[model samples]
Target: MPFKASGRATDYRAIDRFDGGAGWIAHPEETMQRASHVLRASGGEADGGAWVVDPVNADGVDDLLAEFGDVRGVVVLMDRHARDAAAVADRHDVPVYVPSFVDPDVDAQTQPLGGTLPDSDYEVVRTVDWPGWDEAALSDGETLVVGDAVGTTEYFRAGGERVGVHPLLRVKPPRALRQFRPERILTGHGEGVLTDATRALQDALDGARRNAPEVWLNGLKALV
Candidate 1:
């Protein structure tokens, strides 16, 4: 099977619903040339049921929903990653949560995320807070979900060599997303870092701060 831009084959696997009624599902395939993931965190009696974060449009969504529960809401972590959020939201009849900087493009239920996640246990930390651009990290205590703010694709290409941060933000130099200090990180453009996630994030932040030549070159490659 052909892999997505992350250079990894599709990995749509069943989410493990925890005893607390919270779990997650990953959309194996990439649409619009990017990897995507979803978090199934329940809100409460007020909310219909479980909610999703940064969902990608794929065939497995319906099946996952059926297996899990109702998807009451969707969250988009970055402006550039709103590709399939609307479709997924509409399919499940849920609202789409996004930062004010994001443009959903598609016609669906969209609402600006006022510095907080909808109703999930996860909390968002703004990593890229530039004048015109913004990106954040959503953490559910154990797992951290990120957008283009970090990546693992480039590293996968060099035979599992040391992976680095996404190149584009190297120019501005990204701040360390150490607020959450999660053990695992799920990204929107890579296979994800499950081991030493905090250390890996720090290393990537260091590389971005120095504006490493390779990092810049790789960021350029992302454009073409």
Candidate 2:
């Protein structure tokens, strides 16, 4: 499993294209399989604009974003996920938005995320605020975008889950996410869960602790 260091991706594979927008996995062949998402949202003074979340740059991504609308801002949900955020924000001449509690080492100018995103209906939800891990989620009831609290990747899920809590957090799943009953769940890793998303999220959180052993065993099997 090659670790994708924080920088521009050499190539990427697009996935999870939906009505709102699309997502892509940088270095898709890598085992970690980090995925980034974008959403076309509107509110307040703006009509429609694309908000890139935890992005990893690759060819044709700009064109993909263009299909949605103008790039409004780049959002970093987790403190450690500054992957290509500054680069993408700089390219679009927008500021990188992060939660006020986090202070990532990106070069671009940043704004504290709160309330609803400027000109968009997406609301930020504080998911985790631990010593080393800080994360936030975005939602508008129908679509939910998460950082590291949960994911759909092989590393994140157990045997029967469409989405699963992160291995480290499974023992104590983030309670804040239970409030959302989204029709689609977009994650910062792996592909989004497009169908049965609400049930998937509920199951993931409700079963996280009980399934921790299974998840651990599955990880061991993969390593073997």
Best by lDDT: 2
The CA lDDT at 64 in model 2 is 79
Error of 1 at 113 (Å): 2.0
State TM-scores per candidate.
0.74, 0.93
- Those runs of model 2 whose alpha carbons end farther than 4 Å from true positions after fitting are 1-7, 43-47, 220-224
Tens-place lDDT digits, model 1, residues 56-89: 5554456655544567677788766666678778
- Model 1 bad stretches (over 4 Å): 1-33, 43-48, 155-163, 209-211, 218-224
Candidate achieving the largest TM-score = 2
* lDDT, residue 107, model 2: 92
lDDT of 2: 0.85
What is the per-residue lDDT of model 2 for residues 125-163, given as tens digits with 9 covering 90 to 100?
889978899888888888899988888877788889999
lDDT of 2 at 5: 45
